[model samples]
Target: MNNPVITIKNVSKSFGKNQVLENISLEIHSGEIFGFLGPSGAGKTTLVKELVGLDTPTKGENFVLGGKMPSLGLMERVGYMSQADALYGELSAKENLEFFAALYGLKGPNRKKRMEMVMEMVQLSDDLNKLVSNYSGGMKRRLSLAAALLHEPELLILDEPTVGIDPVLRKSIWDGFYDLKKKGTTIIVTTHVMDEAEKCDRLGMVRNGKLIAVGSPEELKENTNSGTIEDAFLVYGGA
Candidate 1:
């Protein structure tokens, strides 16, 4: 916590005339898995997209790894995996890795080593030669995760990473997250799943493009006099 890896200050975003984020402000410390929980259209993805510099805030500032928003220089130190799969269908898994790894300025031995390490972590080492077009939804999700970790980035931003993944595989992926955290990687994940929210070191519950609560899972439930995160969210929603 000595040096926070990510900071958002009064950040807001809009597309055309519709506001997607409203004065969102938060901090993500290094070496932690922080979860953003919300229903669909709750601005979880918008906030994360802003953090990754894919979209700029309309009114405020966002800083990652100490640099201001949308800085090309900071891209190498941050890894991002959006909810949508962004892979080339014609490319083999290994080829896809090669392309993205190169984008992060990786080459030679470092690139190969990282590529192998990420594939192994995602339990897809054997599928390196498979064409992505043949991959199932879960397989593609695993591949996306592998690609995101290929750079060993100091900060990881994952959006609904486990949506289509099976429970066993999902647990393995979360295990990988913890291992990365131990190695000092700051991870930010957006999910609506309550169980996943409970696993985070801290959580931000958002609704209608606004943050309703920020705390550890236990703290949130206790504060709301609820037995679970879902219950707490309901209380916050005045249900």
Candidate 2:
């Protein structure tokens, strides 16, 4: 019954002769975790990039917050963490958070408060004073996640966020996601991991640049008469 926070209409993307996405249509409602489930090269990242306005769809439109994407005004309301880490290696984790917070117009005590809150969510509080270049791959990923959470955006988009994170930390991070969702934050997480996809409220199965199936984990498993999300993915001919 809630309004759709995101809408993709017949979206397609191509790079010259190579097509990366084909006629993908989807609508993500507010206050839920919607996931794009797929293997590498399945166009999951590309689709999200389009939604975040980093890239344009070759032949469709992606709307976020009821407005077409790439709109600068919407930036403050959306938080994005790409498949690649985008952090200043020379700066401390706290400094990186400070920079992003300032860009969102957060200042003084509010900015400092937000930085601490986000870092705590990612369990990187101890390393907040450490330079990013000194952090490990997993640590860097967590820092990127922390920065994205600093603005407390209404919509959160993460691409392969838990890739290098350990199991315990990943679980804690997902707990943080649940907390965000309860606060009515709409989240989109792209991942190839079946178990991770199972955590989503609904999932879009993608393969070879095509959207093969879309449903909640239970619905998908029931439809395919499968035991698990992985089995259901296979039944959908993903593998």
Candidate 3:
């Protein structure tokens, strides 16, 4: 069996009186591309946030890379690209990359090499000297992805990464994901797009704070007697 990179054991989260997640349990295998599929407000972000130790669960536990979560030591092994473009708009793209590289403890030749590689991967190498404030929405999204990949982390957590990207760029980005998978990186992506869900090795369907189903795209479609992921999702949501 493949080693589990991320494990959630009956985890739950609540904000004030609002419950965002409930008894969520999952295990993601190493080198696999896992998709957390759901419509907006389905707690996909909440679940992924817990995996990266950004937000602690109110109940149960989350283990990442064989250690209990919220561990700074473990964080060094994870790369996260949030939905928002968390970039320093005043800085140049290269400057932003340099800053993040330092935070990941990268230095000297390794930092420069990794920065160059990620910039190329995101097709932003030529824009290195451009100020982030002048970038388009799609460019900012790509820059965020480059920043997350700067450390060459073992696991990647991306939340709606392709939202503002064009189809051509999206294809290039997915190609990059396959290249990372070849290098033994575990990737988790959250999205509502059906076509994107089809590319995942396995998917966890979330609805109203509950994980309604978990399986490969084929398994889900077959079991639901549906032709598409959207149809399967409807069936699972009803159950």
Candidate 4:
């Protein structure tokens, strides 16, 4: 296995009196797709935010690319797609790509090439000139994913990336993810979808701010004596 690209040590987070995460610790290695599987309000997004340096833990620490969390240099090496679409309403799809590409220091021919490449990867090449405001919910999601890939970052962090996408397009997106993984891009995805969870190389199941289980889909099922990832999750959740 490659060296650990992400390390979380006894991480915890709290908002006012509510504790969102409690004593979470995990190591994510390089060049694999790791999934955080859990339902809504399970603190999956909060954990991911910490990984991307968008939020800091109230306790413990997070390290990415061998650097401490919230490092500007390390942020450049990571591509993040948040749950909300962050796009210019009046700008065309191409324009949005151009803006973000520039933020990553992509310029001239390189920027153009990357823009085209990511758009094609997300199957949005034909909609390059469409205004973002006019794009449907699913189209917006795809565009957001394309923008995240524009920089070809070593690590890709996606939070609920496939939500609102149709089954056919969702499969296509997953295929693209596998291609990225093959190229040594470590991916961290948070999803409540069981089928998607099974596609991950390994999974960390979170519930009520705790990591309940950690294993590959097959290993999780076998260990829990269950037939599916969902069943394994249920067993872990004490269902």
Candidate 5:
């Protein structure tokens, strides 16, 4: 087994009296694709935000690369793509990438190289000169993904990455994810899409702020005596 890449210990979060997550505990190993499978409002985003240090857990902790989260130093080592697109609508796609690259301390040849590389990965090279404000919703999402991958961080965390993408583009994006895994990057993706969840090496089934099951796709299906990931999710969710 690979070393632990991320460790979530009894994590919980709340907004005033509205609880979002409840004692969620899980471990994601290095060089693996780990998925958090749950429906909307199932607290997937809340839990994910905590892992990326964008939010703090009201209870428990999130450890990444053997150190505690919300650490400024760790930010450079992680690539994060939030549920919302974080691109600058006023700037051209290339300009946005340039800004992010500069912030990551990338300069000169290396910055140009990475910018081209991620654009190729997302198949957005041609659209690089276009202003983001004029891009379609799906194009914006792809550009956001390109920016997240700008630095080739050791850990990649994505929230509903393919939500607005077409089937062909989504497949290609996932293929890029598999390529990254081959290069030994630890990836954590949160998705409500069952087909995407099945592609994960292992998945954590979260529902109603609780993790109901954790296992590989086949393991989950067999354990639940189900034929598919959706069936397994239903059995685990008690639906």
Candidate 6:
């Protein structure tokens, strides 16, 4: 196994009286695609938000790249895509990419190269000059993904990245993910989609703020005595 790239140590989060995560602890290895598999409101997104430094844990700690999270210095080393499309509606896709690239301190030829590369990865190169407001839901999602890849961060955190994507495009995006993994990038993706979960190197199954199981897809199926990931999830979910 590669060195630990992310470590969640007994993490917990609560909003008001509601606890979203409880005593969650896990380690994600470098250069692997780790999936957070669960249904909506299962605290998957909350856990990811803390991992990306967008939110703080109510208790315990999260470390990425060996440093404590919510650190500004680590922001540039991590790429994040939220469940929502956080794009500028009036700006052209290229402009949006440029704006975010500038934020990451990318400039000149290097910036241009990364912009082009990410656009191609998401298959949105042709729509570069189009205004984001005019783009479809799926297009916006792809563009958001491209933005996250702008800095070529070592860690990528995505929340339901393929929610609005068509099957063909979703496959293309997953292919891109594998390509990134080959290049030694670590990815953490949260999804309720069963097929996508099978593609992960390992999975942490979350349900009602608890991490019930952690293992490879095949291992999960074998341990559950199930034929598919979905059935395995059901076994873990007590259904």
Clashing pairs in 2: none
* lDDT agreement with native, every candidate: 0.92, 0.92, 0.95, 0.96, 0.93, 0.96
lDDT of 5 by residue, 68-94 (tens): 999989988999999999999999999
**Per-residue lDDT of model 4, residues 87-149, tens digit only:** 998999999999999999999999999999999988999999999999999999999999999
Give the runs in model 4 whose Cα sits over 4 Å from its true position.
none
Report, for all candidates in order, the number of backbone clashes: 0, 0, 0, 0, 0, 0
lDDT for each residue of candidate 3 in 1-239, tens digit (9 for 90 to 100): 38899889999999999999999999999999999999999999999998998999999999999999999999999999998999999999999999999998999999999999999999998999999999999999999999999999999999999998999999999999999999999999999999999989999999999999999999999999999999999999994
Stretches off by above 4 angstroms in model 2 are: none
What TM-score number comes out for model 5?
0.98
- Cα lDDT tens digits, model 2, 1-239, are 37899999999999999999999999999999999999899999999998888899999899999899889998779999998899999999888888888888999998888888988888888988999999999999999998888888999999999999999999999999999999999999999999999999999999989999999999999999999998998989745
TM-score of 4: 0.99
Q: Looking at model 5, which ten-residue stretch has the lowest summed lDDT? A: 1-10
Candidate 6, residues 89-166, lDDT tens digits: the string is 999999999999999999999999999999999999999999999999999999999999999999999999999799
Global local distance difference test of model 5: 0.93
Model 3: worst 10 consecutive residues (lDDT sum):
1-10
Model 1 agreement with the true structure over 132-187: per-residue lDDT tens digits:
99999999999999999998999999999998999999999999999999999999
The TM-score of predicted model 6 comes to 0.98
Candidate closer to the true structure by TM-score (higher is better), 2 or 3: 3
Q: Estimate each model's TM-score.
A: 0.97, 0.97, 0.98, 0.99, 0.98, 0.98
Model 5 regions more than 4 Å off: none
